[model samples]
Target: MSKTFLKKRYGLLVLALTASGVALATVSQPDLPVAAAYKTERVVQELPMPKLTINANASSYWRDEEVRTGDTLALVLQRLGVSATSIQNFTKSSPIDLKTLELRAGQIVSARVDSVGDVTDIQFFRDDDNGERNLAAIERINGKWQLNTSNIDMETMPSLRSVVITSSSSGALSRAGVPVEIRTSLKEMFSEKFNLDELVEGDSVSLLYESLYFRGQEVATGDVLAAEVRTQGKTYRAYYFEHGDTGGNYYDENGNSLTRGFDGQPIENFKRISSPYGIRRHPVLGSIRMHTGIDYAAPIGTHILAPSDGVVTFSGWKGGYGNTVMLTHDNGVETLYGHMHAYVRGVNVGTRVKAGDVIGLVGSTGRSTGPHLHYEVRINGQHVNPATVALPTPKLSAADLAALKKYQQKTDETMAAVRGLPVMVAQRD
Candidate 1:
């Protein structure tokens, strides 16, 4: 009975397992449509692409043009697309006195334009001989325009040289084939120490001046880097140095102050003067008067070098003094040059003239008897005879002293090398 019951139960269990397996297989498998039943359809659609078009007629809105020679304000405006009416109105209603078109060459003119090609604004910058810059601005206003002028303070360095032609005139430097530029610089450099008109021919000068090099070309003279001048067998050396604490100044090898306080005056660099410092019979005044400054009569216009760097306080006519230029130095010293024949055009009152700049030509313009520069030195408004004044030498810091020692060593070696080669004397003393 047990064997027959077991066989029937096993047969039923196998049939149930088979049915469950078939249901599980059907649930796990996915149903897909037949390739033939589904029609093969392809969709083709067009897209909108952006087409970029650039306007070829539009000109550049900004431009820079260097002011060339013979370029006037009108021409510059016209070149920048300023309309005729705008130009006329600018000329008419402009507050600036445009009668004198003072535009100069080598200046930079910047213009801003609008979409309609009208100049919005224009700026012109020009440099003057005093190393200061003048900026003129033209702006559009209510279909018209206005011009404004302003000044830009600039530090200028001018390198100049001149030769001594005669033993009696300051212009001797210029006459002896010394470039006018250098002659002017020499005057400025020694304005405080001596008068240019008193220089004589036989004087020798050597200078190292600063220049600005742009694109491997010297664009302008910057400053008097260093200089040495020998007048009448007297050697004078000057060097430019910037103080770590104070800033820019000129000094000699000894640590003493070379700057005058007033504006233009002489610093130390000379020995005993030919003329003593005291009240005596005036050469030109023809009366007994105080000889304010000691005279170093070499020749006329030998090459008045600057005693120190300073500014021209007054450079025109003074009461009795002919064609005089007064320089105010940095160390509260003021110097005066009288009897000048002519002056450098750019130098004027309030103009910053560095050391060794020529302020004027030698002439007996004022109460002078001969072509000589009446030189004077004043300290704090008091006249100090430059001949007797104990000028202070510039001091050097320890670090600077060390550096100077190294430089002197190198300079000595260079001088020795040059001396070893050159035995030919160019000029006889």
Candidate 2:
């Protein structure tokens, strides 16, 4: 802490450099003594060493509580062992606006209270949309409460997972020690082509992803860099590559977009494909009949979105179809949606809608047995199979394709290292 202490730390360095036959002509050290002038002395009296004082209650600490649904400030503070008086004092003296302090579910708040029912320290780490953490600390400084806000550094780490599926994709990933967010990202990445609900045993998948962490704890997942899946003797691979400065998108081995220009499914979250679009026995009529549309079972009020850009052709009730809505798209493509609890406001006949726009809610409005969505895709005037319909995929340019190939090769090397897969060895005689 003092000039003398700093000089003592660097004394050895200066002596070593000087003794190596290197003349230290520019070095200035007026206070340093020469070896001939140095002398040892015997102490006539010894000075008593000062005793060290330690706080007995310093180990008593704070607790953290995640803000949950229906949790108020007082409730969260009480859960963290902060007394009522402490909460009152914290609320009154804190500089942060109470209205701006909107406690969201999953946000963490930490607090420590003293023996006399007073708040000694409190901290809350709030993360924003831009992946930045705003740390707010309330502590007793100089015998008074002080509120301070600072920024903490964030880090991202890459992870890899390889799993052999014995049952479902989610189950296999869980057993492979994959993070929840990574599993969700992988599922969403291949939602258009892969039917996660229809996975069979013996299927396998490998994934590489990035996780955003703060203070050594993972808070969010960035993107799935590369993923490969094998099912039924067929392999499907998707690699995330950015084209120019636009943004990154998933592509297959042939440098084609993983998803079609438009999504195929009408409902994002469906309980199951209650019935596929084909000839099947009617559940209610007890007779083999032509099933014109696919049935997606969902809750009573789940959102139903437009598969692609189109104009609403019909938005009212149809016989046996319940509250049905039909949209006319380009290239003689038309889509029909039925069994809606209610149509989204402003969605009506002749109203133009974009792809992925919410059109209605899932319901059993007309002649139906339960809550579900009856989706039908028609080309020209004839009904077509929505599940097997061939959709259009975008292709990458020549330059972009070359870049992607290089990136893919590097990613493959990283994946092999992460999984510790065996490499081929060369032997010479």
Candidate 3:
């Protein structure tokens, strides 16, 4: 080939575009957004266009190759026709070592190359241990390579699967290409409905969940959106809903929560009810007053257990209540414990506590006649009768039920589109 032809073959296609115009619109809303989520505006203006060429006769195009089971940046780029210099720049100039980058088997590494095999730009996502993806890129800009990074939200689609159990649940799910993560999620999602381990030989399961994708390959599985289980001629269906207060939880067809609820009362070493939650005669004030919380008659220094999983919001002295502790749980529920004799060591604001965890002790620190615990349950800042209170589930919300119906309709449509072909790709709304 002529020198002019050789020089032209190795020419680079400069990107007139800049990363500033790259709008990566992310829908911060959790699983299954409302009707307004029909529009997805992610990557409206990417830095490098899909395909480009220097001349009509040039054989150049963008190529996307998946990282194999045991592959490195050098091996994958060499197979993608990237030059030695560009490959070196990509490995050395990346924010993290490209070799040390944890690349999943099906991860997509994209590159655009010229006819002479010199890469113009290369891009891929590097995921942390927490499964969050950050875009890392190296592009030839102004005759020199430059790196860029930003938070990324991968493409999500509804993945449908139907399988019958003839042997074991894990074996059946694994044979159907369901990842172990998704399998574990399916078990937990349907634990309240039916035990996955107890599924009989003829039992069956139909599921709909999110499949995260990059470059047309599924990289990971997301939250379980909906599922159905059929066993012994009985069918149970569950749909996931995102409540305004509760982040995400599953519910049955009649809007019953499938999440495992809190164990019973807050205190374990209880003796008797000195005062119930309501209007009653105050022993210390010596007047009829509205008692906002239930006073459990327990010995001083008795252990106080958290009703459920919650974050400590307050753990200090209050005016009349003296030493107090407050916990904030999901679904707009908050609990307050007053007149504590002593607090559990390391119990403070922002500390997470699970059910049956010791948070404080019971004592009549405030204006009280004897040793007792004043426990209050509040829903949306309004005091309620703690004696007759039950934890509210996400399905009880009218707005959540309506949104769930809409999501169910959309899911049916998606499933109908692939009646026989179970595995298909359709962008989530």
Candidate 4:
């Protein structure tokens, strides 16, 4: 063979062997991990929880009612959602004398009944010199009936207001932001002493009174501490003085009692006068006849109060009068009440009652047309017009006069505080 051909073959074989060694070295090398692109960390926080409250004595249902004129203890309790058995249990277990409870009209009554229509608690409030200090409760404790009497801690604050009578007494007092009860009390205080109907447009009045607060809210208005009324260049002042046994009465600066001895109308706050005490056309008889007594038109079962202090002479069914009641007063005066639905319990013959006492319930059980009271006032067997009769005023005792003078000083201090204008917001609990 030729020497040049051999040299070219040898150079080709060396180049191919060098390329294979470089590829083997690249395939056998280990891989390295790449660095992460982001980092992370955890965070936590805590929050507070709220508190909850619950009332222990609250029942599933509650009811409230007002004492009616003909309401007995059982009737009132029944109206307040108390069961018949519950009422019997309460009356038997009660420690208070039910007979001594003067259940007057307009009294508030409250009851709490369970889901099964069973009364759980029944409560009634009464007032004294300390302002609603007595609480009568009839409740079920540990599945047994119980009656408890407790004293309520009331916060009493004095309030004052002065107003000029531009037109209406109630209106002017209302404009001055006086409460309805307070205005009523003020009117009643001076009703006998001064003629409210004779008040002119320019008359002025200043009043100092008390307000009862419970749980930061005003619950009731207390007695009128003092009042000053100016009419026709004359001023009349009344201050309330409390005397033990003699009772509380409003007395003037000279210690003269302002309350009248006799209430002319037999029914206080009557609806209207249906018939006068004169010759009038009979509604049922359809003829002109003499109406010996005044007729007070009112709703059924309305209260019939006594006109004066007297003893019950007769209480029973009478001809044309149905349930009739006769009272004998001082000086041979006789008052008769006719067509009564019912007579007051324990008010039989020889029962002595004071003025404003509930004697009977108005009804139309006899020969009548509707619910009304046939009130007759006879002086020596002669009927007189009750509307025109002049009532007498009683004189104050020496002890009452002496006590009133001392009370006047306290009223003066209260009036001085009242003159500051804009009754301060009562801070009470």
Candidate 3: 10-residue stretch with minimal lDDT: 10-19
Candidates, ranked, TM-score: 3, 2, 4, 1
Clashing pairs in 4: none
State the lDDT of candidate 3 residue by residue for 249-328, as single tens digits.
Answer: 57777777776545556787555676654333334433223355677788888888898889999999875677899998
TM-score of model 1 (CA atoms): 0.32
In model 1, what lDDT does residue 242 have?
50
Q: All models: lDDT? A: 0.52, 0.65, 0.66, 0.65
Question: What TM-score fits each model?
Answer: 0.32, 0.42, 0.43, 0.38
User: Which ranges of candidate 3 are over 4 A from the true structure?
Assistant: 1-95, 99-133, 137-181, 194-205, 211-222, 231-233, 261-392, 398-403, 416-422, 425-429
Compose the digit string of candidate 4's lDDT tens values, residues 49-150.
Answer: 878775545555656565667676668878866778777877777656776675545455667776545677666644321101244556678867666423
* Residue pairs in clash, model 2: none
Steric collisions counted per model: 74, 0, 0, 0
lDDT of 2 by residue, 41-83 (tens): 8879888999989653555456556677777767888887777
- Which segments of model 2 are wrong by more than 4 Å? 1-148, 164-168, 171-181, 197-202, 262-394, 418-429
